[model samples]
Target: YTEDEGFVYLNSIMDLYSRKIIAWTLSKTLEVEEVLKCLETAKRRRKTVNPVVIQSDRGVHYTSQKYKELTKGMIRSYSRKGNPWDNACIESYHAVIKREWLNRFRIKNYYQAYQLVFEYLEGFYNTVRIHSHCEYLSPDSYEKKYILEQTN
Candidate 1:
């Protein structure tokens, strides 16, 4: 939450295969609509005919009818109640981003927070930062290698 914005929520979708953040939306509300927007963005960015399993915490937004409707063709998995470890990857991502980047800034408003998030996600995390889960390559590089291997 930003100082002036009251409560800013970040809804993100991660592709577990490469640990890439496929899409994200920073919104002022925690409404299911925001989550829907994030999902839509992910769908637009990553075009795939194969169905994928989407895992999330049992948040009200994820459990909503609208969310279910939009994700009709995909499998949905929810974390056991009170067990955050069930969705550890995304939980860790939220922790890492705050500890390494967001914690360092005095975000006064929503726009500032949005800018910081964009820089960390697009400029660094996806393109430059190495992850052991990705075999020490950045998410983008790791994904490229995987695609290249599939074609070859």
Candidate 2:
């Protein structure tokens, strides 16, 4: 969904296992550069060559030269011609944000919105949102639980 303040392109990398957002970026336009920036943020945070399969809609930005360069030989790419369910996880995250955050609040400017997004994501969503995939645990909690379960 596009925001009226601007284009407000939101890019997110989702963990398929727990259906959690590991990384995300918000920008005023849906440029290939902005998309690459989101991917870079995810890579920096994860700091590993994990075999991540990034699925996105058939948007030009997703298929652009810069985006392909970023994912080249690093991450697998998947897309559907016109199906949203093909990338359900991140799509769902977008819906959640709109319903829970964007719809409920108004921002004076992009900077304020940016900060609010950061707080909503890092402060609340990651650690607090109950997810069915993790039996009501948040993403961080679910990851910790998985680690413990694996180490045992």
Best by TM-score: 1
Report, for every candidate in turn, its global Cα lDDT versus the true structure.
0.92, 0.78
Models 1 onward score TM values of: 0.97, 0.88
Q: Give the CA lDDT, 0 to 100, for residue 139 in model 1.
A: 95
Model 2 lDDT tens row, 99-151 = 89877776666777788788888888888998998899999899999999999
lDDT of 2 at 37: 82
How big is the positional error of residue 100 in model 1, measured in Å on the Cα after superposition? 0.7
Please state the error at residue 140 of candidate 1 in Å: 0.2
Q: How many residue pairs clash in each candidate?
A: 0, 0
